[model samples]
Target: MAPDWPAALRVYLGVIAVGNLVWEAAHLPLYTLWNTGTAQEKLFAIVHCTGGDVLIALTCLALALITVGHRDWPLRAFRAVAAVTVVLGVGYTIFSEWLNIVVRQSWAYSELMPVVPIIDTGVTPLLQWLVVPLVALWLARRTVQRNLVVTASMNR
Candidate 1:
């Protein structure tokens, strides 16, 4: 039987929200804001970025679901769904980094931030996309499976 969709979505997004928040806080020192901005501003940046990260994760997952997943997802084609999600997230992150850092000058990195060659995106944000979503998806899948097991046993 199919997994509980609503519970899975909640787990997926909850992991993304918490993971991004912690990741943002951990990596803030690598940005210019760490040194230039006040403590409150830095805190706000972390929260704001975490919110954006959750939104982006949701969008990427939705796109991946439409393109590669089915109504029976997490029970089938999970790897494909995950791969598409990661690829979409990474691609968008690169573009967003270029736009915000180079074009808009909305933010800048410090000397400590490792940047990708030519494209000039931070390694941290790129890595964040790769790591956070995969972990979130994995946990969500686990949650769904456990819920399914419990549901099946109860039904029996």
Candidate 2:
């Protein structure tokens, strides 16, 4: 039987939120704001960035679902969905870093931040997209499958 996609989605989103929150905090020292900003500002930066990360993750997954997913996603079309979602996320991160760093000057990275060539995007944010969502999807699927099995056993 197929695992419940809705339950999997909820688990996926929850993991995304937690993962992004941790990633944002861990990478704070890579940004200029970490040293230049006050304590409150640093906290705000972490929260704000984490919030944005969550939104991006949600949007990317939703788009992937619309484009490549079906009712049995993460089961039938797992690879297609995961690939599309990660690519969308990574593509958006690249564009956003370029925009914010070059055009808007909304933020700047510290010397500690290692940037990708040509793109000039920080590796941490890029890695965040690659690591967080992938882990989230994996955990979400495993968790849902376990729950479904337990429920089935209980009913038997």
Give TM-scores for every candidate, taking all chains together and pairing residue i with residue i: 0.96, 0.95
Given candidate 1, what's the lDDT at residue 62? 93
Q: Candidate 2 lDDT (Cα, whole model)?
A: 0.90
For model 2 the local lDDT of residue 111 reads: 97
lDDT of 2 at 86: 97
**Which residue ranges in model 2 land beyond 4 Å of their true spot?**
none
Q: Candidate 1 at residue 138, lDDT?
A: 91
Which regions in candidate 1 have their CA more than 4 angstroms from the true location? none
Q: Which candidate is the best by TM-score?
A: 1
Q: After aligning candidate 1 to the native by TM-score, how far in Å is the CA of 54 from where it should be?
A: 0.8
Query: TM-score of the candidate numbered 1?
Result: 0.96
Q: Write the per-residue lDDT of candidate 2 for residues 1-156, one digit (tens) a residue.
A: 767888888989899989999999999999999889999998998889888988999899999989988887767678888899899999999999999999999999999999998889999999999999999989877877788889899989
